[model samples]
Target: MERPIGVIDSGVGGLTVLHELKRQLPKEQFIYLGDTLRCPYGSKGEEEVIQYTWEMVNYLMKFDIKMLVIACNTATALVLEQLKQNLPIPVIGVIEPGARAAIKATQSNHVAIIGTENTIHSQAYEHALIRIKPNIDTTAVACPKFVPLIESGNFVLEEAKEIVEESLEFINHYPTIDTLILGCTHYPIIQSLIEEVVGPRVTVLSSAVETGFEVSTLLTFYNLYHANTEEIHEPAIFTTGKLHVFQRLKEDIFQLKNASLKHITLS
Candidate 1:
């Protein structure tokens, strides 16, 4: 069987997750839908996020994807359970994988989680971590500015430094935490800056990497792993907002070539 996996995000942020999925499961095919038209689900109302997420999922279902990955943390936090219950295929979100990885990576029970406003406010990562280990301690910070900086292509500038420093003001007090979870997909772009600010000893984990491992494990358990034939194919990337930016960043920043990205309209 050659069924593809459906990965949807509110914008280019999800590309971080999709990149990991490809690296982990090279044989599997993937269909990525980035709802850039309604980007930044973080600031949106809960009802709006839910509707946009489901619409993206519904659109991807047209491709007959075997599994669905809610690659956006905001979307994952808002709509994961509903999608799991309502959709026929397995639906995996970035939160659980990040929580699991943080638990394992932390030497101290204390861990820090940074994400968008909605994702951090939802307390999804904290809940998942606490559910896994009740005694564990968690500190979550919402860095709303990070997403906008990334979207504007200022991720590497000195402005990003100021924003990162201002955003992580809470980290100064929590010196005990040895692991920091990059809960939002967009955070990976600034992982180096985060690591620099937190010092070398503190481990920075992005959910994208862990989610790929989770996806691989689930596929193995379900026997849905793709068997690659002699020919190789490129994954298709669809962006509802700005296609050129996604394409430029994917090739220049993320180094994801061969995959053709196109502009998509939701309707």
Candidate 2:
């Protein structure tokens, strides 16, 4: 538990990032916290998202974590700069890496982004991409139903496919969008269906995967990489709400084994 990387998200969506992190940095130990009780920060106000994100960060800090990764896009959009300034440890968020990935993958200059209403409304991904490449054209759509569908454990079914198709009809209008950024961490869970609907020619950039790569690079740069060689280190998973749902999703959808869930109150 010494110097573990602390990763927090509004909910299980961050596990997408954490899964990649474990694969990329096999030697490092990690402690992940999901604010599942107050899930879906994407629709919340900026101030509320920031405050809740700070609470998660402060709670994780109590564990003496070496670094923090705010895996929620809403949190990143609302609070990344403030967290970087306020926290002594290095803090990272999902938006920049995802933006950079899209910038790299887009051959046509036209890119599409899908996320929660607030994330799309905030235009964080748009700003990040344009900041990196001013000429790039961006189209961001709010796929608010995607998160609820995934959380409800209904994303893999036929109805979910219909919803995915219906939701992506706008993509047909912009056939030039060769690259699509999955702005919400949760979107990656149903990425295959999305890809299928959008067709294979469009490259889907997963913020979760890109964020993991960023975390790995940052860990190397900071030299705070945990070299815990122990074959088994106790990695803790805590949820602010809905333990059974979290457990079922982790095991069934996320394929995360060997992690225990603890219920917590984030007052």
Candidate 3:
């Protein structure tokens, strides 16, 4: 199957996942839709998040995607199961892969998760972790400020460091937590800053890498690998909001200079 994989995110944060996907499966094509206009789905109500996520999914479905990756933690937490049940394609979410990675990295059997308000409120990561290892000690914190900061493209500034440090101060209380899961895909955008704040004592894991591996596994299991490997495939990127930041990140950060970027409206 040469059909493209569909990836949806609240914003460019999902690019972190996309980056790994492209690296791991260089021949696969992707169509990414970011609901940047309503970028921070973290604080939104449950119904609103579902509606927004469906809009993005419907938009990407036009491309005849073979699989769907819900790259936004908030949307994944609220809507992943529903998508898996409803969509014809295989649906993958960040939470489970992240939980699995955290479990593998934690030597203390204690892990901390940092994501958006809705993701934390949903207790999605906790449930996922506990489901895998019933005895795992999990601490989750909602960093309501992070998505906006990364979406603003100021993630590299000095102020970003301060905000990351402040937002993660609660980790200090969990000394037994040997691993920290960057629960939100957006958190990986500012991962270095996060690691600096959390320090070397704790290992920070991004679901992006683990998510990439999952996608690869599913592609092999489903026999969905693209038939043509000789031709270079550039992902198609779409955003519902401003294009400047998305363009910069796509080129400068993710280094997808060949990817086509466009502005589109869902409603």
Instruction: Estimate, for each residue in 1-267, the C-alpha lDDT of model 2 and write its tens digit.
Output: 247889899988888888787777766777888887777888888888888998888888898899898888888888889999988989999999999999889899999999998889889999999999999998899988888787777677899999999888999999799999999888888888999999987998898777888887887898776666666454578889777767776787666777778988998
TM-scores, all models, native as reference: 0.96, 0.94, 0.98
Worst 10 residues of 1 by lDDT: 225-234
lDDT of 2 at 25: 73
lDDT of model 3, residue 220: 95
Cα lDDT of model 1 by residue, 1-267, tens digit: 489999998888888998888887777888888887777889899999999998899999999899999999999999999999999899999999999999999988999999888998999999999999999989998888888788777688888899898998788898788899998898887788988888886899998888999998899898888776554556889888877778777898666788888887775
Arrange candidates, best TM-score first: 3, 1, 2
Residue 166 C-alpha lDDT in model 3? 93
Write the residue-wise lDDT of candidate 3 on 26-140 in tens digits.
Answer: 9999999999999799999999999999999999999999999999999999999999999999999999999999988999999998988899999999999999999999888
Model 2: C-alpha RMSD to truth? Answer: 1.6
Candidate with maximal TM-score: 3
Show the lowest summed lDDT stretch of 10 residues, model 2. 226-235
